[model samples]
Target chain A: MWQPSIAPDAVDRIACVGAGVIGGGWVAHFLARGHRVTAWDPAPDAEDRLRRLVDAAWPALEALGLADGAARDRLTVVGTLEEAVADAEFVQESAPEDLALKSDLLARVDAAAPAGVVIGSSTSGYRMTDMQRAAAHPERLVVGHPFNPPYLVPLVEVAGGESTHPAAVAWAEEFYTLAGKTVIVLDREVPGFIANRLQEALWREALHMLAAGEATVAQIETAVTAGPGLRWPFHGPCSTFHLAGGEGGMAHALDHFGLENPWSRLAGPALTGDLRDTLVTGAAQVTAGRSTTDLIAERDRRLIAVLRALREAQA
Target chain B: MWQPSIAPDAVDRIACVGAGVIGGGWVAHFLARGHRVTAWDPAPDAEDRLRRLVDAAWPALEALGLADGAARDRLTVVGTLEEAVADAEFVQESAPEDLALKSDLLARVDAAAPAGVVIGSSTSGYRMTDMQRAAAHPERLVVGHPFNPPYLVPLVEVAGGESTHPAAVAWAEEFYTLAGKTVIVLDREVPGFIANRLQEALWREALHMLAAGEATVAQIETAVTAGPGLRWPFHGPCSTFHLAGGEGGMAHALDHFGLENPWSRLAGPALTGDLRDTLVTGAAQVTAGRSTTDLIAERDRRLIAVLRALREAQA
Candidate 1:
């Protein structure tokens, strides 16, 4: 068991297991928020890669007005999981998404750590119940799935298993909130949680449209980015309906266009084999003559700038 | 029958029927793009309302760097549907979303317009097949559904029916493009088209979650706007998948997390009754003590600024 030396108001310490992309992102986020982070990964060059990833992300993070020296000074590398989670208040596990491997690793962490330490699994798959079943103390396990490049984005889904204690949930929420994240509590375990489910529905339709030769990938992408996608972030579906009703709210909108749902084509199956191939091919075609890496980098840079401007305006 | 003043660079004109919110929006858009507009509506204050709407939207259009006095000077409100479509190149029908009313009005416009004039219906309901079947010149009929506040948002889905001529489709695309609007053509007539379908899928799940006591409406709305909704506008579902895959792209992301789809709480019926009531009440609760009219105006103003900034950045 571990002992707490730091005051409650002092910066909390975070331990990250598996310094891959997600784990590296956790390091960046916690470090940026002035939390001391001890990271453990078996990969030979894990430390170097994590450092490089953080370095590469600095420009974008700084563009978002989040760069700070305290974040850089708080990062450390460790070889063993026990050492990483030794006295840490929060532990983030981002190992491979395999169930057995994660369960085994988490069980070890739970055994070594104190009862108060919150163990958050960054698994996008497997509900919290199944993953925490092997933990020595299942009450401390929680699902804290963060979006990619967690330091740049601010969404973290805080889900609890049946065995997870309410204190653990509150602690997880509080922890992420301090790290500049928007925490959403999932009432129960559900697959893909919230974001991914909505994403898949849209992706599936886009793929079907491509498969049916309805429109090219470029056209479909342009349609979304220039159309609905532009307004979606500011106004969700319900608000859109309210606006559509023209002062009558959603009920009026529904009364006017509710019957149209029956005529919509929502019967497409999952994107398997050839359909998936077509979608990939279409995306490539749409992005022809442009390097995806370069495109992504440019996009990231612009996004950071836009977010920064919005934040400054809000401030 | 109308006669075309045959010229190589003849100016295109649009006839707008029903000077309500949508019709007024269309007038603002067309007028802002230098398209002469002939508008007609039986509402007593239709002209005054349309003029006010145009005046209100002018700053936003100018902020987009696409508005000019030359375009604004071209608007002209006519006396009747006969005069509105008499000599115009295109007729935009924004009549109420009633089938019988729309069919009757469309038939009248068809009778008054030239033989080759394209009659585009801005109906969110009533597929092209249903609308065209009622027209005398079915070949000239097509659906040009635009989202709310069409003058500010630039997405128009141009769907053709079985009887719609290929020339009409091409002409409509060119027309919208010239007017600085992004046009997407649908493969077949799908109700709500592409955007609304994806939107409804997400909305259904959100409503279900609220109904099941998973979260309050305010929480759900907060989760969306502050979380995934933040990234959606800049990066769509597919692009987000690419990032989620840790630079490997959507395929890898799908392989890793695709299994979660089967377990998600999606695939539920649309929300109704109590749930719908809860959403409205929740929205009111969250928006209590706030003026919606002021909020809308502020949102519109921000949208205009963002679009202008983006345009300038692109240039």
Candidate 2:
């Protein structure tokens, strides 16, 4: 097992590649934690858009509280990928989900960063085993997946590729934790990891209902926000069922509810033309004439409020 | 079409046919809403268990806010199901999942209740089409499914079967809304209804992961409460993806991320002996030897805190 060249809490320089939504989120998060962040993206307007995204997210971070020296100006936009990682103690790549592009980009980052520095990919779908194939120092490659609006949401899933050292995975987990994140480290690689698999299952089920015309889009949204979604923020599906079993807990739940039920018979529906139109129309009805920009502002507002509420509740 | 004999807002006397967890929760909910509740269950000690359940739930209800004149003494446990429904303005059946048992019980309640007083079944699994088979007055028998801890969680999924009247379905929706619930009325009968289908999909996916040894129970639980679960309380799967697509919304999300992919391949796993053992053991690890009763108390406490937080956030 390889050892981390730099300790997790002592590191102050974070390099971020690809400043789109996810990459820019990482930049904002690292800066808020009082780190010097170097960000690089190929788009001509990447610096402008990245700054705007960070500026939009600042109020929420401020409400959440910043580190001793944290400030947005600590971020430096670099001209090239090599310059970005030239002095970075750690590197995070948030490139597009294309496998070839990610693999090639990770290889370049791996070559430029100091030897033994861990490199994490933010590819939501591809496995690190696949992405690390072209990297020279593959042992240091790991996946550290974060939810959208990473500057706010506390979860980050960390796992290593086949060639990754156990120490590297542990180091990444420690780094995330010290930087104020709740990390889940997987024992072995699983496609889509854990949360995404569970999420996609629900998403696919919703689509099936929409395609079959069994429920309206608004009903689907209400079925969640007004229903199980409330419990989810505190209790997960497993623990929720455990309580449903009464005093007997999960064993009683499994035995009492049985396994082969009608609900389990759901399969992913093929998204056809008619289904696509239904989803588009249904979503429009739910959107209720609000533009995406307007909705984002609303979502961020509510998210910050909810996060503060959760924090107070936990306290 | 059958019209509601009594107006939704005028419902004050409610008959509950079963007094287990779900049934007892209904008792607590209605009692807090200032309704006189009459309940019957066949269990020898059901009264003791039912009252205790309501008492345990009372503090949470009190935190949520009680309707004027609401009191625990307003609940009356009767000797027979027929007596329970005799003078009721509305009847809610929270019977066991056995087809024959529920069918015969609904038939009995039907023979005894005042005419046109709508009856709703809290069956988590059975379709109303099947459950209403033996009821004499099936048109008034609609499904009104609730999440566990029905009082605190504001969602109630309302739907009707093949023989039920559309007017009765509307009446139930209006009543639930007036009595403090967010209702989702399905246009047609769908097995397991809406929320349960979505919940079961996620449950099965978590089980699949557990069975495959890809993640631990703690990891699964943390994966949710820390990750997507935080977002779910306000936003849902569809709207979330809409935001994930950036300024383009749902249509762009669908186009950018193709329909069929690795995540869509999820299917229900068989509950083999080894898998069951793993689940039980993993759950034990999560419980950490805490008694089920202890866990329930903790769950209730946290749930109340979260409900209060959400309320304050919304305000």
Candidate 3:
């Protein structure tokens, strides 16, 4: 990990290591944001694969309206990792999640990357601390976890390793936001990061249901898409449950049924300062600065609209 | 549980017992659908509460274009359960999820309702088998599990007890679909039902994250609304993972990082004959007779549209 000599906002060139599905996705996203991308991979067919992934994604990107001058033509696949980072303003590593392999690869990138260039790993599960152990300049390495199809899904969980400078974490968060991602900057590491932890939990329950023959895979899925999933995009589980509490809101919800609620069998995160600010700010952003009252109204309006739409479509 | 002498599609009168939050919501939904609703509850203020709920939900329902002749005036809250069910074509029990209480209430409804009428419990967790144990006509009793705010959420998990007639299960499926609800017809019972199990799982992981101080209530939340939550409305976890496999589909996803994937520590439901058909049928409904190829294209198109809308709104 290298520190950035240039300001995060001024980062115009991105170096992508590992030109696979995710790596290609990152490249496509950067290109869509009107940035030059230098990508490198060990596989000989990496360029071909990367091109295809980007091509497949371009129409959708076009549908989203690319930034001025954004085009697939801006991508440059270099021969090696060193060449990819030679003149890069920022580096994003999308290598496999194998800890040893990642740590080794990240160390080499650290050796080659310009000092203070700021390297972010796309590993979903690894703590930046574990992955940064082998890096000579670990302070610049940070985790910038993106969801699948990076060009589409907007969340990027940003965190720094133990040795990493907090400034770098802040810088990665800023850079990702500037690149048009909903950035979640973590002050500490958690296995599976934030999203996956939640996902794994829901998935765990899903597995239990499956193993017990409680429901079919399809049943579990519809339980989501048609039910809770409809509310999820606009409100997190907490906020949704808060809505479920009716006019009483969240506190009453907790007091009445949420806390020690039958489902206490499931786990959750502690409520606190930074996470609170993150949630509040993220929520404000999500709702476009609408008040909770305004949001509640919008959610109901949208839900009714969607419900009507689905009923009509499926009827 | 009672069986309907009338055709499932011919049922125009609905009886809702225990008019609290869930029952009130059911009343609102049935009212919105143009059905003459007869509701009863032990609470003295039940009529006022149910009227308020239907009134509050009316504008949204109106925006969706109410069915012909649909009006809030159609709802009739009676003084007794027997009076409520005397002329009802179907009975929906939304009592609290107390096992013995629900069993007794359902049994009473079975005795009071018109012969051959179907009785459905809106219990979230109790297995239909357990709840039907007290009923003399358990064959007509079915679990009509619904998501919270049942009037707004389109999903309703319909299942039959061990003694329940398969015809009754089919009848409930047709009935709910006609009522403009997406119904998952299950042959057996699973505690927490399917949706709650999935919800509890995700919630469990969220709790773990909290217990460890991994993140805050808000962080765990935004992580969803902004990330996986966006995809969930359009795709279930399985379909989402299938797409995540990048052309490899569900099988490749299972083989690579999914089967024994660290996240496997999470659980799910088992696949079976009737349940399998539900899954497939649900998938088909979710896609609205669209091919997988068409679905992929539609998903990408919609994702890009949502991403663009979010960026513009949040900007």
In terms of TM-score, the best-performing candidate is 3
Give per-residue CA lDDT, model 1, range A190-277, as digits (tens): 7667665555556555554444445454555555655666555545554555456554444455556553344224433333344333
Return the candidate ranking by lDDT, descending.
Answer: 3, 2, 1
- Judge candidate 1 against the unseen true structure and give its global Cα lDDT, from 0 to 1: 0.66
TM per candidate: 0.79, 0.85, 0.88
User: What is the per-residue lDDT of model 2 for residues B71-103, given as tens digits with 9 covering 90 to 100?
Assistant: 999999999988999999999999887777888
Query: Across residues B95-149, which tens digit of lDDT does each residue of candidate 3 receive?
Result: 8757889999998998898778888999877788888888878988998988767
Collision pairs in model 1: A31-A71
What value does the lDDT take at residue B155 in candidate 2?
Answer: 84
Candidate 3: where is the Cα deviation over 4 Å?
Answer: A1-3, A258-296, A305-315, B1-3, B259-296, B305-315
- Docking tier of model 1: it is incorrect
Which of the two candidates, 1 or 3, achieves a greater TM-score against the reference? 3
Chain A TM-score vs. truth, each candidate: 0.78, 0.84, 0.88
lDDT of 1 by residue, B21-97 (tens): 78988898888776789999988888887897787666656644554444766888877889988888888999987
State how far residue A299 of model 1 sits from its true place (Å).
Answer: 24
Question: Measured with DockQ on alpha carbons, how good is candidate 1?
Answer: 0.15
